[model samples]
Target: MIKTATRSTIFLFLLFGFLGFSQNKKNFSSIPNILQQIIPNDRIDSWVLVYNSYGKNQEIRTSGGKKDYTPQFSGFNLFPTEDSFYYIAYAAGGKMNYITDLEGLRKFVGKIDNAEEAAIVLTAEGYMVDEEFKDVAGNYYEDTANYYLDLGKLTSKECPYQKTHYALTVSKSSGDVSKVKDNGTYIELYNKKCANNPRLLKIQKKEEPKDDPKKSTRRK
Candidate 1:
């Protein structure tokens, strides 16, 4: 799939409420208060940080938080950058938080590689784990930000519906994705809220056309 949006501002966090991924922050005995805290046993290679920038001026970018998320993500603590405006730091060794400052982040990722770029694009587009990719593990990416995934504008999603490759636009959330596409695999904990979803049921139930009985007959 092609990654859309060269520049994205995730202001409206909406859609599927999946569980945000978490990681434990490694505490060091020599914890420096400054940006020198980029220590992963004092060694790291690849890492990723997904974040959205916000400010008072909708036009001007400023050093602020990533979307509405706090420094605390699951178990990992999100480290802010000097310039938390136009950057998504490369993944170090473990799943680190999104840092805006490029120079400050380099101390961790070492160098921004191609893999890091792709990862950034994917996370920005709100797909894979960046958005709400389940099954890779118990980690559910329940991003509340309004996102655009391919052609399908998913307003919301309750669980993971294993697809067989059919392109469909799910505008709203669902309790039972099976009602939408009966012939697909799915993994879910609960959908008690989606049992009476009239919209999902309407998508599959097509009205049958009645045949005209008053048409011309052979030789009656």
Candidate 2:
């Protein structure tokens, strides 16, 4: 009788353990396999994971405020013919950091193997392009030339709306972020029309001169 009771207790424990393990596995598998591999289990549980067809967005509330995690290629229209690039972003504390060149992402997520394959899986989810800026006068513009002009006008006391659109486009290409430039027309427009604005002047000062001063200014 004693032996039978011990055996019965052991059997029940094993059965319940198996069931619990199976349930956890099922829950984990529900997430995209690539994400399941990339995000650590604890972080996955604590963060609210939001998924769109394009990629995953994780939001976590810290003592400071909310932080968002999204794909590296966000805000750009990805062409199907382009090489697959993969990256992760952590945005919080008024700053955004991209993880691609280093092993930080893999280490943080606890996944080391099959990174390229995982990126392909995530990219397969979708392509995204952000919206362009539109002026109060109802004109839509892509580059920043008209954007800053309209921005200055809107911020003036004369305009009650005081609204302007600003956004950054970041893309990952061959394990590095791509360089984005304003259209030449936008640059010329900003210089001619909005140069007087303090903000515009600050931006212009940051631009490096195109020609080498020593070469161009030398007696010729």
Candidate 3:
């Protein structure tokens, strides 16, 4: 019999795989006023922010009256707006970088030449949260209440919030973004709203799993 812990690990692995592990579903929450302040004209319904704790640290002053400080590192934030575009911003290494669209994000990542590809790549690495949802039965569901990402061994023992990583996901198109689990559905929606771009088609093709001849023969 499989151990309980092993079984749990297996279950989560399967669940993540089924949901396209990189797509982190999240619940809707009010975008921070600070973030909203940055983009006043655009209407944003969803967003994601992740701190890259691996970078160089800086001293942060405590809020209390006492003069105390702590170390903190900058990270990145991704958000989609009413317009068919997403924004990526990063503050690290004593420098700040912000990009308003996929093309700019491509330059920031300096990896894939394609903008859509770069957007997907950066989104996978960041924390993701989804918006609120209501089923046909009129039951409302939300994910922002108690959801957290387990950093596992990467979690710091000294930190108060152990094994917790903040993340979120925002849909760029219409319909219930929270229900989108696999890459196919995501790409389908992307195409509908963004006009079936060639790069996204390439990503869809790549995500298709090739049939295994050996496995098929064994089944027969």
Candidate 4:
């Protein structure tokens, strides 16, 4: 009698385990339909995975902030004949990235000089880029043109320390480039906090003229 009871208990446990596994598949059944209706001219692959960041591992949240582990998928497609785009929904991680291709994604990651959490998504409207960089602990400094290139080549008329993080083709009704500069203003101003001897901004500019002393006097 004891042996029979033990066998029955084990059977029940295995039966419940199999049921649970089968239910997980049901949860994913909507993935194909969702992809077909939403993603145009694309093949999709869906996955559910735990994400790790900031030394913590947690489930993802949807745009509505509901915590759930549904299959998130990526689709690759060609649009407008020559243009290519891909889309991936990351229901967790609280972020989305878009890029032109996998190669572009890889290059973007390599270019990040400061360590920060990031993800790439592929899109048709050029690569939508977003990133975070470690800010100087405090203060701002004026940087040379070389310094600007080393960090990220950005043109600014009023500020020297601002950094560029995103680019988009701006068009007015007449199809002319808009003349407003936005982004990196605070990054430029905040740099003054950490700069040593703010006067060095002048010195750095001075070094360039030394290469041609005659040119230096011409400016004066």
Judging by TM-score against the true structure, name the best candidate.
2
RMSD of each: 20.5, 26.1, 20.2, 24.6
Question: What is the C-alpha lDDT profile of model 1 across 84-176, one tens digit per residue?
Answer: 333333333444445544334444333222222222222222322212322221121122221212211222345432222111122223211
TM-score of each: 0.21, 0.24, 0.19, 0.23
State the weakest 10-residue window (summed lDDT) of model 3.
Answer: 133-142
Model 3 bad stretches (over 4 Å): 1-28, 33-62, 65-76, 81-124, 132-220
Candidate 2 lDDT score at position 42: 23
Among the numbered candidates, top lDDT falls to 2
lDDT by residue for model 3 over 1-220, one digit each (tens)?
4699899999999988757633543223332322232321123232232223235332221111222223224233344333222333344343444444434443444433222222233344442222221111011122332222211111222312122222223233321123222221111112333435567678789999999999999999
How many pairs of residues in model 2 come into backbone collision? 0
Error of 4 at 207 (Å): 22
Q: Model 1 compared with the native: what TM-score?
A: 0.21
Output the worst ten-in-a-row residue range by lDDT, candidate 1.
Answer: 25-34
Model 4 — which ten-residue stretch has the worst lDDT? 141-150
Q: Of models 2 and 3, which has the larger lDDT?
A: 2
What's the lDDT for candidate 2? 0.34
Per-model clash counts, in order, read: 14, 0, 10, 17
Better of 1 and 4 by lDDT: 4
